[model samples]
Each structure stands twice: as C-alpha cells, then as structure tokens.
Target: MTTEIGFVFAVLGITIALFISDKLRMDLVALMVVAVLAVSGIVTPAEAVSGFGNPTVVMIAALFVVGEGLFRTGVAAAAGNWLLKVGGGSEVRLLCFLLPVVALLSAFMSSTGAVALLIPVVLSMARRSGMQPSKLMMPLAFAALIGGMLTLIGTPPNIVVSGALKEAGLEPFGFFEFTPIGAAILLVGAVYLITLGRRLLPARTSEQQTDHCDVPGLMASYGVSGQLHKLVVQPLSPLKHQTVVEAALRSEHRVTLVGIRRSGTLLSSILPVLANTRLEVRDELWVYGQENDIERLCLSHRLTHYGSPAKEISRMGREFGVAEVMLPPGTPLQGQSIKEGAFRQRYGLSVIGLRRRCEPLDTDYRETRMEGGDTLLLAGSWERIRALEGRRDLVLLQTPAELGEIPVHGSRAPLALLVLAAMLVCMTAGWLPALTTVLLAALAMILTGCVSLPEALRSLNATSLILIAGMLPLALAMEKSGALAFVVEHLVSWLGGASPLLLSTGLFLLTSLLSQFISNTATTVLIAPIALTAAQLLGVNPEPLMMTVAIAASTAFATPIASPVNTLVLAPGNYRFSDFARVGIPLQLLALAITLVMTPILFPF
Candidate 1:
C-alpha cells in the first residue's frame, strides 16, 4: 500500500475503534475523520465539506420534515391505533398486525421515529391484554429494521447505497427497487418472530411498564390531590375581567392557576393558563396551592370556592394533559429552581410535581432546585406537552394516551397524505429527481400547514445528518487514496475464484457484524464503495452486491445498542443483553440466508 493508502486505513481504523468504544458521540468521531482527511491532503478542504451539500444529505433532511408532517398530522399514529383495534388482545394476533404495519410505516418514515411513536401504544396494548411487553417489543424493533429494506428512502443505509450508485456514474436504484427483497424479508421475519422468536422473548417486567399514569393516578402519586381546588370568578370580583398577569396570582396570592374553563353558549372550553388569559365572571379556575393560601385568594378576590374539581380534572383530557419529563445529565436547567427558571413562562407548562430517584417529592417542589435525573410532572395543553418531545434539555418520558387520541393538526392529515402520494408518484415515474421530489413534498407540507417551518426544522436529527455529512469525506478519501481498491483486492484474493454468492456472503457478514456496534449509515458509507469495487473486479452485477450490503447493514438485531429502535424498547421490555442475542442472532442469520437466496433471483449476477 502507498503511504496515502496506509494513512487513510489508519483513519478508518480509528473511526471504527471510536464507534465501537461508545465513549464519544458518533458525530464527534465523524468530524474528527473529516479533519484528519483534510489535514492529510487525502481530500481537499472543499471536498471534505462537500458532503453537507450532497444530494443524499439534502434528501434525508427533507425526508425528516416529511415524516414530521405525517407525525404532527397524526398520519402515523392513526395506523398504530388501527393495529390495536384489529389485533385485539391476543399476543399472536397482535404480532401479525403489528409487524407488517410497523414495517410498512418504517418504509416511509424513520425507523426510530416509528418505534418511538408506537412504544406507548404497544405498552398500553400489553397492559390491557395482560401480556408481557418483552413478547412484543423486540418484534416491533426488528420489524422496523426490516421495513427499511422495503424502500429506497426507508433508512439512511438505503439512501447511502443509492447515492453510491449515482456517484459511480450509474443510474441509481429506482424508488421501489428494494421492495421485493425487503417484502420477502419482512414476511419471513414476521413468521419467525411470531413462532420461534416469540417463544424466546423474556417475560420480565420493569418500571417502564408502569411509567405512564392517568390524570388521577398522577395526581395521587404526586400527593397533589388535596392541593387542587376549583373556584368561580364571581361578578364584581377583583380578579374578574383581569388577565392572569394583571391579577398576579402566583406572585401575590401564591397559587398557580392550572387552567380556566369558559362556558360558551354551545360548549365549555378549557383555556391554557397563560399570562395574557383574561379571567371573566363565572369562569371556573383550576388552581393549585396550600389550603390556607387558596382560601386567602378566594376571600380576597370575592371568588366562590367549589372544593376540588376532580371531574373537571378528569375531563381535562380534551384540551389539557400531563406529561412526565426528566432532566438528563448535564441539563442547562440544573442548579435553577423552577421559579428561578420561570418554568411556566418559558415552557408554557406548569411544574406541578417533582420526583427524584423515582420517589415523589412531597415538599414545595416549585422551590426545589432542578437537578439532573429529576423527573417533573408538567401540566398544560397537549400541544405544549407535545412540543417538549423535541427539547434537548429535558427527556419527555410519558404523555397520557389522550395526547395521541387528539392530533395537534388532525385537520391537515389529508393534505399531508396528498403531498406524500404525489411525491412518491413523481419519483416512481422519474418525473423529477428523488431529491427534487422530496424537497417539493416537504415544502408542500409546510405550506399546507401540515407542519410549520420551525417544526420541520426541529424534526431534523442533526447528529445523524452531521454524521453522514462528516463521514462522506472519509469515503471519498478512501476512494481517492486507493484505499478502497486495496481493501477490495484483498477481499477478492481471500475468496479467489469463488462464486459471486460466496463474495456476497462475505460482504453481508462483515457489514452485519460492524453494524451491531456502529451507526448503520456510517457502516454502509464505508462498505458500499468496497462492494461496488469488488463487483466491478469480478465482472458481476453491482446491483445485487449493493442490495446485499444494504440489507446486511440493517441486520442490527443482535444487541440493544445495535440501533436506536432496539435501545428504545430495552427498559420497557425489561430485556437483558442476552434476551436480544437469544432472538436477534437467529433473526440476523435468517435475514442473511434469505438475502443470499433472493438477491440473485431478483437481480441476477
């Protein structure tokens, strides 16, 4: 190997080592690769950063916005709900319904997002059916991974491999090129999971199974039952006709106004308690405070105290809800009390209760200093609670089922669906480039109010995007420095004169093994060029080899850390590391066997 080839290999080794160690963030490691490549003259500075402008990067980013539009408009959640209704309470029936639906959804959106959105729904199903979450969680994750095999835009690996084809001056894979093989895998994998795999799932339960609590249960756990009271703003009352800020409820009366009920001529609507929400006569106010403080406020403002509004609180699910949010380690909110942070004014959610280490704090939690690992129960409109899912400072643990039942943009679902369909049709017909079609769909989503611009922006996973962009330069460096040829030559020599099937098997095994430890997208980026080179050297079809590599990269099933989707179900499923191996190893092998047999049939060498 030449000196430049040796250096590029060194950079590749270090990147793999860092990814396997799990000490530093993947994106950080990717950035390090870019810096080293640029500094070593393996790639020009402009080429190193050109990944940010790559059509693959832009297309993936646009896909995120499109997925967010679907999520915000309840397109995905509706499908999940449909599964519950059709599957009923039987474990077998549920798997049959869940695996295909989740896979199909994953084919269109992010696997991680599909899994995250359905986790609570699946948990609810398990709870209602009296089945163990482990029995279903692993299948949910594995199916999502398999679903990515079904479409070109299903996952990053698919996009990466397709981009590889385009970069090599070949016609890229069609939009549905992966469907036959992907569909076959999903069908076979679903059967395996339902039978043999289902028998291997753990039956253990964990705290996550009971993490979500109903409104009454949450209040009872937080010991806030006695503190919540309802009062009427009587005519001529000092608080009537005044905004919440003008009345100074929290500052002067030391009581938190949770929400206000305005009884209109046709119906009663619950208004989120904002600083500018003006109070009118006969408005029912849900307030939280000590009994003495509440009494003082009621007497001073000429309000009629009506004791606790338990019924109203239960009915608050229509417009209001509660969610549990935890402050992750190193959160910026650390060291500041809720009051000091202006929690309500900043987030538009009231911090009603706090828990440290799973134990509820019965003290004045509002005055308690925020700390990492602290779990706070927030009460507000469902819209505000939903927004917390995107915040970096706090981890949104659970929102009540009511949150899913009510879509924030339910009216825009049709528009979102229409845009998605049009984009797919255009791409499949080659009416526009894939990236152009995706960009137009994302733009339509924003213009039709399916998802706002800020929401679309927030939906983009910067880590994945940066990791892909930063690592693209390394792929370029490998190709530019002859490192890719070196690796391919060695691989071919190792399988000298062997059939193309043997070569594909080797590529599949290597890709699958590496994917279990690192980001699948990164793994695909590094392996795709080598696969392409090997195919060219052998004078065989590169399409089958590329398909094999893409499928193998998604076999991230044998470990919890394999994929974010797997990690998502870990605690909820009460799974041990071995539980994954027990089910995932067999599944990975099954996928390999299926891919090898089917690839040649679909795209002959």
Candidate 2:
C-alpha cells in the first residue's frame, strides 16, 4: 500500500513540478496526468477527465468574453488613463491616483493582466515625467493584486472562495461583499508602497532592463519555435555582400529565406528591406528549428543560432497563446475573471490574447489585462467574432459580423453601474441568485445585440476552460486518498494548538507559497475547503479562516508564477524568473502581516 501511495505521490509530484516548470504545455501535462492516474488505478480515465466540462469552468471562459466587451468600449482604457493622469506628480500623488484606479479596475478585470497593460503605460508616463520605473512597477503590481480582492469575480482567489463557500452550504460571495475591506487593503497597501517601497526597490527602468538583455550587440535575438532559425539580415550584416539567391548557393545547409528584420537604422530613409536582402554570416536568421536541430545543422555545415541563443522562448507571447476581443457596453462581463463567471459555454470563443489602451495608448495588444480599450486577441473565426455587435469602442481584430459595424456606444456605463447596484441589492435583499442575476445580464446583452451571441462565443477562453475541467479529478483524488485530511491533521499538529492569529498567519504564508508554485485558482480550491474543515475542528466560524486563505491565495505578489497576469508581463517586461521575487518578497511579507491582523479583526473568531 505504501509503495502504491509512493507511486501515486511520485506521479502527482512530477505532474505538479512540470506545471511549475512550464516546459511542457500545461494542457498536455494535464492530459498526461489524467492518463497516468487512470492507468495507475488512482481514478478511472473518465473520472480523471470529467473536470474539463464543469459549468463553473465554462462560466469562467464566458466571463472573459464579457471582459472583452468592456475593454473594447474604452471603459477600462479610459479609466486607466484617468488614473495615471490623476497621479501625474510626486510618487505620493501617483499612488494616490494609481492605487484606487488599479483596485477599481481590477475589481472587474484581471489584476495581473491589468497591471501588464498599465505597466508599459505607467512606465512610459513615469519616464516622461522623470519618475523612476522601478518605483512604479512594484507599486503597480501590488495595486493590481489588491484590486483583485475587491470583487468576487475580480480574481481567482475570490471565485475559489465563493466556490468553497457554496460547497460548504454557505452562500457564495456576492459580487462586492468583500469590497469594503478590499478597498481598505488597497488604501493601506498604496500608502505603504508609496511611502516606503520606493526606498528598497531595485531602481531599474523598462528600457534599462528590456530590448537589450545581458547578451547584447547584433540587435535583438528572439526565441525561435524550432531549432531552425529564421533570422533576417540587416544592411549592417556583411550579407549586403551578396543576393539571396547567391547566399543560398554559398551556404552548405539549405537556407530558406522566409522573413526580413527591417533595419532600424535604414528604415528612416528606405522602404522595409524584404526577405530579398543578401545573406551575411551575421545577418539575423529566424531559425525554424531549435536546440538539437541547430546543433546538427551547425555541426554538418556552419551557422550560429544567433548572436546569443536562448534556451527557451521569450515570455511575451510564448508562455501561453493570446487572443483579442472587444467589449460592448451593456455586457455582463465588464467585471470578472473567466473562472469566477465562466465564459466557455456562455460564449463560444476562447481567449488566449489581450491588449489594453491608456495614455500614450497601448493599443492594448497581446496578453494585456482586461482594462477598457483593450483589443483582446481571441482564437476564433469572424463568424464567431462578429457576434459582439454593439460593444462601445472595441473592434474585433478578425472582423466577421459587419466588418464596418460600429458599436452603439450607449451610456451603458450608467447601466453597468445600475446592474452592479442591482446585483448588490439582490444579494443583500435575497431578491435573486447572484449567478442567475449575473447570467441574466449576460443573456440580455446577447439578446439585445449589445453583444452578439457569436461575439460572445469569440471571447470565451479555451485554456481556462480546460484547466478547470481537467484539474478537478486530481483535486478529488487528493480528497479520496485522504491525502488532504492527513496533511491537514499533520499541519494542525505542527501548529500545536496555535491561536487564531497564528493559524491565520500560517495559512496566509502557506497559501502564498503554494500560489507561487501553482495556479492561484488551484491554490484556493485546495486551501478553502481545508480552511473550513480546520475552522470547524477548532470550533470557529469558518468565515475568517476561509477569508485568510482566500486573501493569501490571491496575494501571490512575489513571482510571475504567482499569477497569469504576472506571466504575461514576463516577456514584454524583459523580466527573469527572479525579477518577480525582487519585487514580490517584501510585498508578500507585508501582505501576509496585513492578512493576519485584518482577517480576525474584520470577520472575528
């Protein structure tokens, strides 16, 4: 039995390690794990794969579509602009202006994604105004995180918390039940960051860090898909010596010319140098293959991968695929993560890309958070995309509906507010189910053509849908194996009858650590149920305990691994894995302390 247990544990551990490593794609790993556990008899294949179809998972994807509409209408974009402009002076002025905006926007959009969109915007502003990017980036990251806590749909943690509550027979959280306290945390965090954070942070500007990595010279190097490179030669490359046809003759290996890297120095005076540019040894080649292919090709003939070869793909676009969408006013998705609300079944599209706009406009492209004015990069056809008809400002990149169709751009801002207010009222007065009310608003948007049904489908997220559905059996396995309970029993014993304060602190720290390694939703899913069980065993209202876990789970401020938004920025920001830690460690510690002190005070024993 112990051997079997060890085998299961080994498989689970390796699966989790692969997820954290992100070397193999997450979905592939999940599928592999499903097969492994099923073959191992830990679960049947059908049971292992059941999580892929959860309604909640579908709703999460749908929520992303709704966010797409909000982004298109310039709602989030406009708000982000207002925040930066409002912060236009001292760092103190900036945080005062920025923090609330970050929190408010994050209430409806992705904190990590929102921050990625805002970072470039804010950094540009900071540079223009003589402010340091270093000072602003950390604060920006923290604001995005705290803002996530403001609404049930704001972040995965809140959604997981709500799901756990429902599982425990208590009501799931309303859209803004935690807002009052969340706002407080935002304020306190902003104040803390503005006053003291700037002092300790590494003062690196976006320019200082990116474009030119440590391996500099010969322009920029990109992570190629395969070992084969597809580099374009600049006029600077001695490649100007010969024609493309001639270069192909001179090269031993078959050199296929595919694309051209426009010479930045020559572009000012000339047209874009097409792939016709002659080949020089130093000319940029975007190799199609990677590692082994490069080695074999290079060994057989002669060619370098680039000035400096990268072991992995860049962070910007490679971590995950990206998709784009437009938000029309009156859409219900304006304020949520796909996980909380579920968009896969609600809408048909899957979101893999995102973009946002702010002053000095981002055009909000590619992995940008759900700020208004974001042009989401969705993976769907135009027939599917054209469904988002009446979105205010967003234009689908892949136009299928009415290519020339302009959004109605009504005063849905007010209507949106009213809808939120009504949802709050329903939650407070017990007028309707929160999910039902939110779903009604979504349905109305579709029916009214504010967001066309096809458009809704275009905005759904396929990866998240798979994530939620695929991972559940694994979560269930832990429970059925008595793994979670056993872990909890040992943890309680480890704590040694600790006080609520100590337990809260412990839970917060542990969840934060877990979040850094796993999906925030995954972290919350496992912890929330455990927290409730622990509270019950300890004779306490599970509210505070659950809240502790939820807050900690969402507060993965220290690593890109902590949140998807952080990962989105990894490439664009030119950040290394450790960079997240540089900013995250202090922020995590402070957030943990705050959670410890605040949870018990607010929710009480």
Candidate 3:
C-alpha cells in the first residue's frame, strides 16, 4: 500500500476504535476523521466539507422535517391508536397488528421516531392486557428496523447506498425498489418474532415502573390524591373578588389554588390559575393542601368545601397536565430552592411535589434546596411541559399519557397526508429529483401549518446530519487514495470464484457484524463503496451487492447499543444485554439467509 493509503487506513482504525469504545460522541469522532483527512492532504478542503451539500444529506434532513410534520399533525399517533382499537387485549393479535403498522410508519419516517411514538401506546396495551412489556418491546424494535427496508427513505443506509450508485454515474435505485425484498423479509421476520422469538423474550417486569404512570397513578404516587379539594366561594366570603395572589393562600394558608371554574360555565371552560385570576361568588376553586389547612382556610374565608372533585380533576387534566422532571448532574439549579430560582416564572410550571432518592418530600417543598438527581412533579399546560423536553439543565423523565392524545396540530392531518402523497407520487413519477421533492414536501408541511418552521428546524437531528456529513469525506479519501480499491481487490481474491450467493453471505456477515458496534449509517458510508468497487472488479451488476450492503447495515440487533431503537426499549422492557442476543442473533441470521436468497432474484446480479 502507498503512504497515503496506509495513513488513511490508520485514521479508519482509530475512528472505528472510538466508535466501538463509546467514549466519545460518534459525531465528534466523525469530525476528527474529516479534520485529519483535510490536514493530511488526502482530500481537498472543499471536498472535505462536500458532504454537507450532498443530495443524500439534504434529502435525509428534509425527510426529518416531513416526519416531524406527521408527528405534529397526529398522522403517526393516529395509526398507533388505531392499532390498539384493532388489537385489543390479545398479545398475539397486538403483535400481529403492531409489526406491520410500525413497519409501515418506519418505511416513511425515522425508525427511531416511529418506535418512540408507539412506545407509550404499546405500554398502555400491555397494561390493559396484563402482559409483560418484554413480550412486545423487542418485537416492536425489530419490526421498526425491518421496516426501513421498505422504502429508500426508510433508513440512512438505504439513502447512502443509493447515493453511492449516483456518485458512480449509475442510475439510483427507485423509490420502491426495496419494497419487494423488504416486504418478504418483514413478513418472514414478523412470523419468526411472533412465534419462536416471542418465547425467547423475558417476562420480568420493569424495575422503573414509576417511569410510565398515567395521571391517576402519578397523583397517587406523589401522595397528592387525597389533598385535592373543591371549594365554592360563598357570597359572604372575604376571599370573593380577591385575586389569587392577593388571597395569599400558599403563603398564609399553606394551600395552592390549582384552578378556578366560573359559576355558570361548562366544565371544559375552566380558567387557568394565574396570580391575577380573581375569585368571584359561587366560583368553584380546585385547591390542594393538607386537609386541616384546607378546612381552616374554608372556615376563615367562609367558603363552602365540596370535598375532592375526582371527576372535575379528570376534566382539568384535559387542559393542564403533570410531568416528572429531574435535575441532571451539573444543573445550574443545583444549589437554589425552587422559590429562589423563580421556577414558575422561568418554566411556566409549578413544582407541586418533590422526591429525593425515591421518597416523597414534605408538602412544604418550595424552599427545599435543589440537588442533582432530585425529582420534581410539575403541573402546567401540556405545551409548557413539552417545552422542557430538550433543555440541558432538566431531564424530562415522564410525561402523562394525556400529552400523546393531544396533538399540537391535529386538524392539519389531512393536509400533511396530502403533502406526503404528492412527494411520493412525484418521486415515483421521476418528475423531480428526490432531494427536490423532499424539500418541497417539507416546505409544504410548514406553509400549510402542518408543522411550524421552528418545529421543522428542531426536528432535524443535528448529530445524525453532522455525523453523515463529516464521515462522507473519509469515504472520499479512501477512494481518492486508492485504499478502497486495495481492500476491494484483496476481499475478492480472498473469496476467489465464490458463487454470488456465497459472496453476498460474506458481505452480509461483515456489514451486520460491524453495525452491532458502529452507527449503521457510518458503517454503510464506509462499506457501500467497497461493495460497489468489488462488483465492478468481478464484472457483475452492482445492484444486488449494493442492496446487500444496505440490508445488512440494518441488522443492528443482538445488543442494546446496536441501535437507538433498541436502547429506547431497554429500560421499559426490563431487558438485560443477554435478552437482545437471545432473540436478535437468531433474527439476524434469519435476515441474512432471506436477503441472500431474495436480492439476487429481484436485482439480478
């Protein structure tokens, strides 16, 4: 090998080591590869950054925005809810219904997002059916991975391989070229998971059961269930016509005014409890405090207490919700009390309950000093709670199920669907490039109010986009320095005269093995060119080989760290590392056999 080739391989080795070690962020490692290649003269400065402008990168980014539109407009959640209605409480029936629906959604959006959108729904299903979450979590994750094979935009690997073809001056794979092979694998994989794989999954209940609680369960866990009371302001009450702040209920009476219901309005017309919200005669007030304190407040103010309004509290949850949040390590709020930090003013949320080390704090928790790992139960509008999701200082541990049922833009679902269909139709008709088509669809989603512009921007996964962009230069460096050719030549020689099926088997094993450790997208970026080059050297069609690389990269099973989707289900599924291997290894092998037998027939090597 030449000096440049040797140096390129060294960089590749270190990158893989960093990825496997999981010590540094994958995107950071990718950036290191770009910097080294540029400084070492392996690729030009412009070429080093060329990946950001690649059609593949742009198309993938646009796909994120489109997917977000579906999420925001309730298109994906609707499908998940539909699964519940059809599957009911039968584990077998739920599995049969869930696999296809999740796969179909993953075929169009990010597989990770598809799994996230359905996790709570599945958990609800498991709770209602009295089945262990483990019975369904692994299947949910596996089907999502398999679903990516259905469309070119389903996963990054598919787009990367297609982009490789285009870069080689070949016609790219069609939009649905992967559909036939993918459908067969999904059907077979679904059958395996529903049968033998189901038997392999663990039945242990989740250790962190507190992490998935509904509104009632959350209230009960926080010891707030019996503290809620409804009070009607009598005409002679001193508190009538006094604003919430003027009443000083929390400061003097040790009670919180949760909300106020006007005397002559529908139950749904309850008004939010702001500091300036004034009380009037016969107005029903939702108060939370100790029974004695609430009684004293009622007697002193001449208010009539109506006991706990369980039904009204349920109705209030439609407009206001509760969530659990924790202060992550190194948070700025570490040393200050909630009152001192103006928590309500800052986040528009009230800390109604606090827990330290899994034990509930005293009711007078407002003055308690904040510490890392302290959990707080916050009450606020669902919008405010959702806004806390991506903040650095606070980690949102659990959101009530009510949040999922209320879509931010539910009325725009039909518009979002129409835009998605148009984009797909335009791409299949070859009337526009895939990138242009995707960009137009994303823009339509924003313009039509299916998703706002800021939401679309936030939907773009920065780490994923940066990782793909930074790693593209390394692939270019490998080809430019003849490193790829050198490796491809040896790879062919090592398996000399092997039949196409045997060759594909070798490729599948290597790709799938590497994917278990590395980001599948990065694995594909490095392996696809080699697959293409080898096919050229052997004088055969490269389509089947390219398809092999794409399919293999998605076999990120057998480990919790294999894919984000796997890790997502880990805690909720109550799974161990071995649990994945027990199920994933066999599934990976099954996928391998199917891909080898099917790709050649469909793509014609």
Stretches of candidate 3 exceeding 4 Å from the true structure: 73-76, 84-95, 105-145, 148-181, 191-222, 226-268, 272-316, 323-406, 410-414, 427-430, 499-501, 507-586, 596-605
Please report, in order, the local distance difference test score of every candidate based on alpha carbons. Answer: 0.79, 0.55, 0.79
* Best candidate (score: TM-score): 3
Candidate 3 residue 527 C-alpha distance from true site, Å? 9.8
TM-score of each: 0.58, 0.48, 0.60
> In candidate 3, what are the lDDT values of residues 177-269, reduced to their tens digit?
999888988999999999999999988776434346776677777877677788999999999889877887876887876667785452332
Judged by whole-model lDDT over C-alpha atoms, candidate 2 comes out at: 0.55
Candidate 3 CA-lDDT value: 0.79
Q: Which stretches of candidate 1 lie over 4 Å from their true place?
A: 87-95, 102-184, 191-218, 224-268, 271-316, 322-406, 499-504, 510-586, 595-605
Listed per candidate, the RMSD to the true structure in angstroms reads 10.2, 19.8, 8.9
**Pairs of residues at least 3 apart in sequence or in different chains that clash in candidate 1:** none
Candidate 2, residue 416: lDDT: 40
Q: For residues 246-300, write the lDDT of model 2, one tens digit per residue.
A: 4442133333232333432221110013223555544444433335544555544
